[model samples]
Target: MELTNIGTVRDILGRHGFNFSKGLGQNFIINPDICPKIAENGNAKKGYGVLEIGTGIGVLTKELALRADRVAAVEIDTRLLPILDETLADFDNVKIYNEDVMKADLRGIIEKEFAGLRCAVCANLPYYITSPVIMLLLESRLPIDSITVMVQKEAAQRLCAAVGTRESGAITVGVNYYGTVKQLFGVSRGSFMPSPNVDSAVIRIDLNKKSELTEEQEKFFFRVVKAGFSQRRKTMANSIASLMGIGKSAVYSVLSELGLPEAARIEQLSMEQLMKFSVMLMEQTKE
Candidate 1:
């Protein structure tokens, strides 16, 4: 049975007396094609451990359990526990935890249960918590090899945005620092039950082994990036000045020394340039 087929999903939910909750972002994918595609993009193969968030009705969870060696799904809603049990009963390797993923100790879980394996994270992220969830996975020490997630289309654009684009923001730069993000495919709003107002896109993030800077340098770079976008309409120099509580003239001097345009907006600077500017700011602060 196709996972995305409304009839099948509805039947499963109805049988279990399940009611979709908007607070949980319970717009389940009704398309079978998207489920396996998400697994494929996540590189979920036999012998790989997969971490899935929000296993509502086990639509995507079923696919992950089928393709991956072991699947650990963290679901927030306790009501879905029995539903997941019914759907995933045949797979012994699959474990469903009733907890908020944001608060769950994923690293400890992975270390204890799935030690010494390359893990991949796959999810149809809740629209409300998409950014935080993705950031949480990326920053975890659990050794995630890659991530494939279905997110709101606009958020996907921002995640994959180029430096010069309007969609570029602090999150874009942050995402770039950890990995390369690419939009794989798009799904119509109608493809979901209790359809969302906007469409969604599948985004694949490939973690990079070589980081451009040391940990300290990256932290400082993010501080500057966040300051730059703190006031989107202001020039980078002005924004940085406001954020740092420094004079605009000093900020302009830093920009001039770095050869960046005085009129440049926060969205105009590349990641490398932002790092350079951040380093300059730190040096000046020390002086």
Candidate 2:
């Protein structure tokens, strides 16, 4: 079955009574070249199991199944279950779970489904939930090797942005804290059946096996980061003081100790600076 064929796709969807849901951000990829690349770069191979977040008529899901040892997809839209069944009927290695990826027991699923095989994640993510989903996958410390996803081009820039740069956001820091991200490729807006307004890009995040901070310190670091970026225009000292309920003087003192100007904005602080600043501020909080 040519999943990307407009006639085939329409017939399949029509037969299954499927209608695109804007609220769900349903944009099925019609580009034949994209899914194979996503599957390959995602590390879907003989010894690897692939966990897919969304099954858009089993398009990418089918590609992952062809390459990976096992393919498990968590799709929130139950309306696509019957469609997926028809689409993916030939693939015994693919399992479909009708559950929200955010709320699903991903760790449990990985353990049960992948067993001895190494695991990776591949998805054509909905633009609205991109950051939250990526953060969840990273923060949960899943045993997956890498996450390859297609997101809005603008979001791709933010996600893969350098932590201390203007394009960076809280998500950039959060993502970099857990993994190394790289933009893979770009896909035009016209690549989908119901094309999105914005172009999209594929990016990969290779999980870091080692964490620089302990559990307590890690939590504190994120807390400080959240506060730092809450008001991007404000100086880091001011933003941190305001959102974290710490005195501005104390924040200024920390900044001075770290050799950062009191006027330094959060975007201007490097990752090393942020780490040092977070630790020092955490110590002061305990005092």
Cα deviation of 57, candidate 1, in Å? 0.8
Residue range 1-287, candidate 2, lDDT tens digits? 99998899999999988899999999999999999999989999999999999999999999999999999999999999999989999999998989999999999999999999999999999999998999899999989899999999999999889989999999999888888999999999999989899999999999965889989999999988888788999998788878888898888899999888999998888889999988988888899
Write model 1 residue lDDT over 163-184, tens digit each, in one string: 7678898778877878889999
Top candidate (TM-score): 2
Question: What does the lDDT come to for candidate 1?
Answer: 0.83
Local distance difference test, each candidate: 0.83, 0.92
What are the runs in model 1 whose C-alpha is more than 4 Å off? none
Q: Model 2 — TM-score against the truth?
A: 0.98
Candidate 1, poorest ten consecutive residues by summed lDDT: 134-143
Candidate 2's displacement at residue 130, Å, is: 0.2
